[model samples]
Target: MEASELVQRFVSRMAEGQPIHTASRLLDELREDLIKIGRRSAFFESQGLPLQEAWVGIKFGEIMTFDTIYLAAKAQMGFDVVLLKDNVSVQFDITEATDRNVDRAEEYRSGPEMIVEDSGEIARQESLFEKNVGNRLKRKSSDNLIVYVNTGWLPEEKFIEDALIRWHLSFKKKFNSAYLLIRGSVVQLAPELQKFSNSRSRENGPKS
Candidate 1:
């Protein structure tokens, strides 16, 4: 079938009550596009340019989603993912009465722990709200074409570790140049992704 015909059918299937089946097929058809996007993004990184700068693409998800996709795309393009956290002021003071850079330690300790707590609480609320809204919208949209994007260049591992340490007083797992996701269409692409590069050229297209 033509790409236009396939898209229409997929959209129609979504409008009807066949989301599961339709979305699965639509993903099959778009897998090549996704992989191409991933590969091109990787190539751009080699030149120290933004992935989006090197290719034609669309932003499908919110900030968080985009962040995850960027990492995955980077990996697909053969690059390491680095996580960095800034504005983390650690102060210590070293006096005759203290050992090992006590002044610097004190400086780091002086930052707004309470402010972190307050902001964390708010973030938790917002995250919960976003999840609920996302799930509900997922259910409502028969097409099931939800996209999220996070453009902030915060280091993923550091961000998680710092957030956990600050809010829960604990450390989380470390990540390096990898994509991690909890939900959305991208997850579905994993198994069949190896063929994603040639997906658009498949004769039968994506199987229903």
Candidate 2:
């Protein structure tokens, strides 16, 4: 099925107040399948294949994350959604997943840095952030700058916190708009800085 059709069916079943137990299971299966299809389709399109070949190559697991988030937002809050490489931004409404939803908060927090580790991922995320921010300033940027950081793997909280404070102070001195959405423990931001700094140190090699 086409992505749109699949989304519609999923939403329709959901709106009917179907039992979460059964519906969620089905949704999970369908979402995984659809995303795999979508990813294959995207790959084929990139290869300049004909539309039919692209469609046939699509797998749902590849796009399941985007679709599930979109559907959740649509069903709960009626928000119009747009998908980017690392995050999904909602334009018309933001009620579905507020800052308080730990899951959404965690996603906004960690999703960006996860993208930053790889050059390709960084370029993709940067393009999307730029598109979302447009003419806006960076720090006062509000919800426009969410990224994932893989906080689960980092070290102690204090170490990360100190790093974030130092980074924030340095960045703020240069540009007040240097804010970022850090994921993982609330302390992951500092560790991310340390991670980057450590990587740079290794690249620069030993002091004289």
Candidate 3:
């Protein structure tokens, strides 16, 4: 099928039903694009994430539909999918979502903690999130989004909640929003994260 037709199908399916579920399908459709960008086996290995498994790509379920839709559209349009194992962001030209000039997005996460308990893995991932925030923020995006994907073992709700709290506490002000892909589901970080960001700006008041 032509890329345009595929993009159209995506838009149609999305408009007809639950966006949360639609987003997962959209990601699946673009699986090839994900793998294409992830072809850099050497790069993933350099980062210490098992290159063999890295190309498997991330997954998302049905937590935050709108966020998923936004990401799905971008990914479908062909944003560069970089395997910055500890971080994921997207860079793209604002062009039509056709096959020819398409690309994907970037997602970040710490290398999986195979031996550690869930708490330890969560804490370690959180630390990686905190440690990488500054560097990820440095890459300016007109879209102003900070996106991350958790590659750890099955992420539970508690992990999501805790990680979001940390995100609000840490990088809330620097980016417009944070999107997380956990267990094959895409979700926006807490709304309060953005609210807190605005609050901080007000408290600090404009820098003179």
- What does candidate 3's lDDT look like per residue over 56-170, in tens digits? 1212212221222222334354432222221333332121111112112222232243444578766875565444432443453533342433333333445445655765654
Which window of ten consecutive residues has the lowest lDDT sum in model 2? 199-208
RMSD of each: 21.9, 15.1, 14.4
Compose the digit string of candidate 1's lDDT tens values, residues 1-208. Answer: 3434343443344333222223344444444543444432222122332222111111122211222111112324333121112422111110111112333223112212222235675566345434543333333322112222121111122333343233221111111111112211121211121111122221210111
Error of 1 at 200 (Å): 22
User: Number of the top candidate by TM-score?
Assistant: 3
The CA-based lDDT of model 2 is what?
0.31
TM-score of each: 0.22, 0.27, 0.36
Model 1 spans with C-alpha error above 4 angstroms: 19-22, 30-147, 150-156, 160-208
lDDT of each: 0.25, 0.31, 0.35
Candidate 2 lDDT tens digits, 49-101: 12211111111112222232222333454432222224443232111111223
Q: What is the lDDT of residue 147 in candidate 2?
A: 26
Against the correct fold, how does model 3 do in TM-score?
A: 0.36
Best of the candidates, lDDT: 3
